[model samples]
Target: MVTPSTQEKARLGGRADVGAASVAGAEYSTIEHALSDALAAHGITGLAIRADGGIHRFDSADKPKGNRNGWYVCPTLEVAVYGFWHTGEQHTITTGGKADPAAAAETRLAYQRAREQREAERRAQQARTAEQARRWWAAAGAADPNHPYLTKKRLAPYGLRQRDTMLLVPLFHDGELVNLERIYPHGAKKALFGGRAKGVASLVGSLASADRVLVAEGWATAAALHEAMGVPVVVARNADNLEPVARRLRQRLPDDVTITIAADDDRFTEGNPGATKARLAALAIGAKVLMPTFCPGCARCTDFADVALCRKERVA
Candidate 1:
């Protein structure tokens, strides 16, 4: 009796084991089989290829997560099964079908043209969005103290405006309004789609005469912290923008000015993005970090504002 090694089986592209069963260690003979096995191992069962070089997760396709495939790979339009699932790691094996050089050249040219067109369209759209944001800023009145989100958060609107039941928060980049985030009565929040989102922030207080400043995520948190700490809090809006906003602030602010990253303590979520990003932003600038102090036996609170409000309620 003869037995094939795992690497040998992979090279042969012949399935040593096939089924819905555990073939994680088992090797496959063909590129299709190996690719299929890789995806199946990651829980992508159906593997439906869509019309736009996209691989669906199951028999019926839904919106791809991360706004990108992020899961499967497609080397060519004709040879999709040649691709393998990348696990955000350095892929070692290179068994996928080779794309035709000439065909790839044409695709590159087409992609360039499409990218340019999209860029032009995006610029135009941003201009339109900026104009709309300016108009809304002018037309809307000051945010009401009785607004649902404001009341629930127990924070007054710094410079926000009311549009019907939604509170409009203007987001700026380089002193120019680029986008707006609307807070609904139900606490749902959304930024204007297609508008520039990165590195933009909504200010809660004046930066004038400020030697040390606090930076945080979310408008309510920043507002609450500014009230409690008596320092200007720059709302970085989200975790991903922390680094960019911090770098920009470092460049723009004075050498003597201190920037403290008041990161949200995202204890519920995996990876603790809020605190991790805060530390990264502070580390990049050689600044300080002010984490939220959750009270003893606190279970749900994950931010400075939440903790502050809890303390206030307890006092009352």
Candidate 2:
């Protein structure tokens, strides 16, 4: 039976044999002691890196808290960030101001070791998950006319592959397949775990010499707009990622190409993160915002896809 102390150690990267209780304080002496504490186990689980070049931690991989990365250490910014998803505790430490060269070097080395371990873990996990996505993508037939998500959304699958009953959308970054988002028949969705997500997005139509492009939070929503407008849609996967993915897209495309931020109006949510973030992203790149219009008393509809489905139903 796992004791409370043991469980806590596991969550803290499972090196309790050399953890805070054992190595910290009067029990150990010398510079080695300080180095040990600074370079805690940090574990292989719950480890991920953002596209913005930050190392991150999650509470648990099995039951992940999807708000933001739990803890992150940014080497470039010379900062370390810590936050708990449940209690909302956050802290940041800037290591750049250290005056002692030896101490600073020690600190850098400690963090470097920890970062290397976590990065190795990330690469391995991504390789395994990417392979799985590839096999699923390979076996999937073209989107069927009667696939539930397609039929319900009134959208066609443009190169969207499926495995079994789940719709698979390949997420890529810099022309490499890094992750995937699987959509259920009822519209429930999830992605393969332990892969880089920030700035990673799915594309529907080819951007080859296109003058206009659209970006949105979800694949279904992108598909809806692509069908209606005949423009390429980039799926940023989530609202929080709009800015990162949009910034990258802006940098990649020509200055003349019009990039529209198609936002989801989360009317039911307080602060409406979707629309707010989309606008901010658009503003950052001097792009335009395209929001969905809802019908009278349409409290249930939050996105262009929802509005389109509602209209299609009304017409039928």
Candidate 3:
């Protein structure tokens, strides 16, 4: 009988003994397989590994469908790096091979490059979007008083402009017009795609020569508060932005200027995020928290705007 070497015997037995360990049902037969399994573990699946030491991106499971926020790169056959842009999450993996510090270093450099590239792209997109916003704002006409949205909300235009059928509420960042929140007739609202919205806000009344400024979540809420109390109001747009907007307003005004955070009491939603975030924002700036005081047995009212409209309807 012919004696077979250890390698030949393994081949003859239909198995390759490359000393790769298995984990979580992932076959570590090769670097490509190992990387694919690691990605699947993070809920990112159905991706074809290039294995050519190049960066690749795919849709992240946590984000909406078709959003390619997840990225991975294999700097060498042994080492790979991966991350999600939306959440700033990152991970590293290596094949069942000898530890190579040089390969690990290459992976780290690749991740840094990926992050820099993303930031550059984001800045470019924001710049283009801002230019478009300015053009649209300049061309829009004053909002008609009888528009369905304004009538339904029982609010005056308050200097809001109208483009076609959409009501345009100008958004400012550092006193520059950077975006517009378009409100449709059916009450839907959206900002321009790729426009910067964080820390941006709208003004309901003039802050000049004013000692008290109120920050509220929505434009209608700001309008209602301004009309009721005759105080300048800043519209933060949403619950998540309450803190950033409040902090900026506090810094811009004089020390004696009092800021009241008018919270939307989202009593129906679990945890009432609006009221919670509003209190946090007020605490941050030492501002007073003002929550909506609903009338007796009123369950549908949530914010200042809702209360104002409800009272108007009762009078009508």
Candidate 4:
């Protein structure tokens, strides 16, 4: 019996000991001719025939398996049909199954359009935030030439140069700077508990005269509340820091003072550390926890300032 070498066995779809070239050759020729005719009718190009009775339009690195060794097809244009060869028989595996070129083009266009829209929105948001920050500084007396927080040149002093710098979000009462709380960016090395304003008995002392006081988590939220309620506001640098501020308020203010902890709905959701802090603070002080409805696209209504603005927009 004639034995086939490794190369010859691969050519005949057999083990090294088997000589199946004669059977393969007889069956493959008829199938190959029919497949070529079909490919021509479909306007496919770059056609190449393989020794193992397969046809392919593209170069593939993967080794063909089983009966597929002699059958391969790829579309040269947007779509292409595939044909299978079974011994002397020819079978069209797929026809009129080409991918839509227009659809692929539309996908790319849609991605580009989305990217542009996001970029535009980001720029607009930054502009609006910067304007809001400017207005806040002006309202808090930081923009005044004689203000202690302002430099001799009339600019606000840039604080701590280190990575973990504290930002003071000031709460104003009747145009007077009454309370200030320190805050650091998220994931900073510093602790979440912030320092209170100098010479102030408590953060709540600023709102003593007001019938209702709004408490919030951040400076932005405090600003939002001030805009919304037109009442006195106090900002907690972070949610966890609310307890000390609340404790101070209880000691300084009259027993009848109505303090509202502006809670964010996000706290009720599981695994929100900030919300957890707010809840604990409210419970300790016996303060009313007011959770405002969040805006549709807003991340969370954690801060009074954010809630105030978001709520107004929703109502409008």
Score residue 220 of candidate 4 by CA lDDT.
51
Off by over 4 Å in 3: 1-30, 42-46, 52-54, 97-107
What is the Cα-based lDDT of residue 21 in candidate 1?
13
* lDDT pick, better of 3 and 4: 3
Which model is ahead, 3 or 4, in terms of TM-score? 3
lDDT of 4 by residue, 150-179 (tens): 221122222211212344444433344444
Off by over 4 Å in 2: 1-109
Model 3 lDDT per residue over 150-209, tens place:
999899999699999999999999999988899999999999988988999999999999
Question: Which 10 consecutive residues of model 3 have the lowest summed lDDT?
Answer: 1-10
Top candidate on lDDT is 3
lDDT of each: 0.67, 0.69, 0.81, 0.43
Ranking by lDDT: 3, 2, 1, 4
- Provide the TM-score for each candidate, comma-separated: 0.71, 0.69, 0.86, 0.36
Candidate 1: misplaced stretches above 4 Å? 1-99
Q: Which ten-residue region of model 1 has the weakest summed lDDT? A: 12-21
> Please, what are the lDDT tens digits per residue for candidate 1 over residues 1-316?
0121222112212122111112444443443544454555444455543424433323212335533322333333322222122222111121222323343343333333433444676689788888888888889999999998888888888888998988999999998998899999988988886788789988888899999888899988998998887889888899889888989999999999889999999999999999999999999999989998887889989998898788888888
Q: In candidate 3, how many Å is residue 69 off?
A: 1.6
CA lDDT of 174 in candidate 4? Answer: 32
lDDT of 3: 0.81
